[model samples]
Target: MLNPKWESIIRFKCPDGEVHYGEPTADLKSARVWTGLDVWSLQPTDTTRHVAEILAPYEPTTIIGIGCNYKGHAHETGIPLPNHPIIFRKLPSSITSPTSLVELHGGDVDYENELCFITSQPARNVLQDNALNYILGFTVGNDISSRYWQRKDTSGGQACYAKSFDGFCPIGPKIVSAKALQNFQSLRITTRRDGEVVQNSNTSDMLFGVRQLMAFLTRGTTLPAGTLVLTGTPPGVGSYQTPPRFIKAGEVLECEIEGIGKIQTEFTEVNSKAA
Candidate 1:
């Protein structure tokens, strides 16, 4: 097994205005730049600098999402627990930095706080017991959604199209290596909107855990290295609220996981002409 001992891996802009991928130092305020290296080709280097801004670690080859994978989330949506993971594809273009602005296209824009993992190596027909070996690390992600397009439009109810808007997925502040987590199933996940905690749950409640998801997804498909997987959200999504609470322009949404860091995103309305 290739277990990495990194506290956190990130892509950041240094004070000199150049972007580089690096691992943060013990203080978590400064980073050691991996000069002339891509994230996958990273090697230990002594060059370090103060971070000016944090960016999304890297562009994933593909972004996969699990829907209604939590019991409470299925109940909230009035859908029964799935016999298998409800898989969906999120376009890589929808990805944005942790603190980026998520533009809404006028309808019920909702938030789904999820635990995400990145693949360390290509996997095909991977077994559950060996799935962890293929994992690089984990991070926090928000599966920003547009309910109208998800449920009422011509392409309604299709998760791929409904959740494929620009900036619909905001993930990362950093990636905590898989070796860093003692127990992946025990971590707590929470989502807050405008400072109010809206979703709170534990990974133990996931109907299908990480190992199962990995095995299932790679059955006959090749999961390329650097693939990102959003392991579903828990209950308390806005569309299921009593009066239906939706994300509006200028609102802030925070998605956090106990072991991994949090990702905060600000919502903005998409201009009519731009839409």
Candidate 2:
């Protein structure tokens, strides 16, 4: 059986401008030494600089994004209730960790702080009856978007390009497993920008719960171990606000869930050869 304790993590920033993975430890002295030597000693410290050069956490194999899963978000968008769960994919390259900078382009960026869960096993056609068994954990996510691209239906594709931009999917500080949720059906999701409350809703609003979502996605596709499913976001996404607010450069975005820890990232514009 896997351990039920949730691991809290942060990318350790070294004096040389390098970011290395570090897990929390009971002994502060031991943890600091591990961050400085065990983690960073392995990477090259030669001069390679960008305005921001942080790397995304390296565990998730696939990122599955859910859409309109929250009743409030669905109602606010004026879309009819979905008969089945709506899903999308975030190119693995888009994933970034907490405190990294999310670049905004075309002068507008919107935020959707969301509740996301991870899978423990590889399962195909995961039955709704056994869905909870496959859930390894949950984490914080920011489903950043561009109002113009989404509303105008850019490129005439499926969902929207607003979702596919580089650094658009900001996830994690660490994973918080199912047992931590206490009762998965009752977790709460919250989001804030620069410390002002923007979104507050309960997970109970999910028309399709966590298990159902896993079952729906794996009906035909194989859900590999380490897959992350962003269950969905509530109403109050920046795009839906009156006059439509977008994230400006240097703005802070914070996403959190009751059991899962919070993730904070800043906003910047894309630069050539960006990470």
Candidate 3:
């Protein structure tokens, strides 16, 4: 297992146009990406640059999203708590930068703010007691979806299809090491739409905590290094609203996780005529 003592690790482009990994400065306005180093052997150089030069940490090999892992979220969706963890895969092609514009394909677009973690090593049939050992760090992610395709387009519901659109998964800003957080279960997660708080809840509300989810997911499966896992969203998703509120073009969505960081994304309409 790869564990680092750094407060946060970031992947960014320097003024010289080279990407590197390093910890963020105190105020988080800038970062210093490591030189000639990998996650397992990170060494920061004497260089700090503005946050604008940073990119979306790294390109993950696999992206997994947990469904209805929170009780309140399941209630809001009128779905019963799942006996076992529900997992869905998001294509690597769907990933975009932390501050990039999400092209909204005409449909019921929705936002799900979630706590995401990345693996530091390959894990197969990991036990709950040793699950955290495999995690490198945690970050915030927005699981953008199309409700129409998620629930109505297929015979049942095609979650992967509905959420695998281009630029659907926006994660980052930075990855806070697991060692930096005292209690992973007690952190607060909040989501905002147009500066209005739409979702507010704590990580303690998760039906299956991080440990259980990790152990269950790794059963008979190998989660390779740099694999990202989204822990699911809290209540207050737009699809659950009384009037069913979906994200509109030009709207800004922000996801913040206590002890981690915040990532904001803007929604833009895709011109079908140009497609």
Candidate 4:
């Protein structure tokens, strides 16, 4: 278990263009720099710096996405709830800054607001009850998707291809340790598209809780330290909406969790030749 004395941590750019890890203040405007090299054990020095820019918290060893794990999401899509967790892999290349732009490939892009958790240690065959002990911390992620490639008819039902594009997964603002959240359940999650609320739900809507997913994922599958798992998104994704609302180029998407704060992302169309 990562019993971090610090409540939160953030990787940010200093005024001099150097990058360092520090503890984010309440307003997230400034951070107290850490002198220690090891992030798991941070010793906050007296030095403090203004957050010139907030970067993605960690470059994960692996990015795992859970599908149809929310009851309302399942019901909306008319897909049956899984007896087992439905999981997919997202390449590390998809990782991007929490405040960065999500490139528009060909429109039909969808938004999924989810709770993301990172593992503290190698885990294989971990039991459900002890799963929490393996978690390092929690943060929210916006699992951006390209709908055309995600459909069964086009991509043979594989989600990785559509979801692995550059900047497809923009996660952070900062990371809040699991010890601080105490309970993952009952936390309110909200998503806004162009300043209008579209997804509003709670962590309670999850068909599989954090413990269940951690145990199931580590069943004979070793997840190395820093593995990021995006627990399923709640109901009200753009794909499952009536008439299916897709993202437009130059639009903004924001996903926020109750305690950990929010991440705002904008989308821009990328030309195939230039991409």
Candidate 5:
């Protein structure tokens, strides 16, 4: 019975190169602060002192990707519109912060911004009508893809490798409360590269609405609390462009969803030596 709308949590980096975790309060001036070496001298929270990689607000144990859930996207891909939600899984390791870098592995890496719904409770066989009840909140996600690895005869593409790069799934900034999105039936999603507007669409254009998407996913699977399901991206992907495109080192991708907030991440060249 975990309340999805309980106390809000903030994850921040401290000067000592450590990440601090705590509930944000009105008294806290800076959201992210530098405590310096004095961080070791500060008093601990009443519960327990944690001064390491601060746990993410939602420690997602699993993640799923709903593919081509948007009507426009399916048409662009020249694939038949799925009567049900098209889903895939992004490795939990892919999740990173807003300002983090999404590495371009010298391969054809493309950017696809998406809306992610985090689960609040373990659920299976949940009806679409009651889907909202299980949503904890929403966060922005970038589904970096390698088109070469994702293509198959006509259906059933491989994703585990192409979509699971170290920083391929940049997600965050904050998770807006579900209530904040009063009507998910209509949401505006936008993505910009550098300063040029790229993808822009509305959730209303989705071939499968959130409720139906959730129900379709839950039909045969037990979706646990902390599970994140990316609801797919709109058109304007680099892969489908006339000239063809791929993310290169140093490009910035910014995404914003109505009521959910914005997330911006840059691209960096992946070092094969370090990989």
Candidate 6:
């Protein structure tokens, strides 16, 4: 499991033009450099540097997603409450920096603000009671989906293809280590599009909490260290809006989690259709 001593981990480039992993200040504008060779096992140095850019925390070993895990979201989308987590995968290549610019592949694009967690060590058949021990940290995520390919005829009702386009998974701002974050539940998660509030809800709405999700996902499956799991989004996604609004290219979406921090993703068109 991850070293519990870490407060938060952020990857950034300093003004001197050297990239390094460090612990961020409350505002995230500066950081105390981590001098250790292995970033996973963090060791702090006394030196602090001005943060020039904050990058994605880390490239995940695997990106696993859970669907219909929020009660309000289920009701809004007309999807029945699931007895188990609806598992899906997004290719690691789709992972992008916190401030990345995504390319729109089709006209139907939507955003799902999700809370994502990373595992610190290999885990298989982990008990719910001990699930927290295996977690490294938690961060903000935007599970970008393509509605056109999500149809039954195009994707055969599977989520991978419709959601695995490049830059589909934008995670981080920084990772607040699991042990450091006292309360994962009830954290306020909100999203804004061009500074307008779009998705607003608390983590309390999730049908399956972090512990339950970790336990369920590990049953008979050996999740590797660095495995990143997107623990579902709350209600208020673009798809379920009254007019069925979709996110368009060149618009910036900011997803913020109470304790973890915020990430901004801007989607751009690469000869794209209307969204």
* Highest TM-score model number: 4
Give the poorly placed runs of model 4, Cα more than 4 Å off: 36-38
Clashing pairs in 1: 150-157
For residues 17-77, could you state the per-residue lDDT of candidate 3 as single tens digits?
Answer: 8777878876666776566556667766777677656568778869999999999999988
Error of 6 at 32 (Å): 0.5
What range of 10 consecutive residues in model 6 has the weakest lDDT sum?
A: 35-44
Looking at model 4, residue 255 earns an lDDT score of: 96
Give stretches of model 2 more than 4 Å off: 1-57, 272-275
Top-lDDT candidate index: 4
lDDT of 1 by residue, 171-202 (tens): 88888888887577889898889999999999
Model 2 over residues 1-275: C-alpha lDDT tens digits? 23333343334455567665444343211122123332112232333222232234444658888889899999888899999888777767668766677778544678887878777778788888888788776678888776666654554534446676877788865555566564767877888889988889988999899888888888888888778788888998876788878788888878877765677888876786853
Error of 5 at 87 (Å): 1.5
A best-first ranking of the candidates according to their lDDT comes to: 4, 6, 1, 3, 5, 2
How well is each residue in 1-275 modelled by candidate 5, as lDDT tens digits? 33433233445554457565444443322243322222112233543223333323444669898888888888898999887777778787887776676677527789888888887788898897788888877778888887777767422567767787777787765565576666766889899989788899987888887788778888888998778888889998999988888877888989878765567888888777887
Lowest summed lDDT window (length 10), candidate 5: 34-43
Give the CA lDDT, 0 to 100, for residue 183 in model 4.
73
Each candidate's TM vs. the true structure? 0.95, 0.80, 0.94, 0.96, 0.83, 0.95
Comparing 3 with 5 on TM-score, the higher-scoring candidate is 3
Question: Could you tell which candidate, 1 or 2, scores higher by TM-score?
Answer: 1
| Candidate 5 global CA lDDT score | 0.72
The Cα error of candidate 5 at residue 78, in Å, is 1.6
Q: Cα RMSDs of all predictions?
A: 1.7, 6.1, 1.7, 1.3, 5.6, 2.3
TM-score, prediction 4: 0.96
* Each model's backbone clash number: 1, 1, 3, 0, 1, 0
**CA lDDT, candidate 6, residue 231:** 89
List ranges where model 1 is wrong by over 4 Å.
25-28
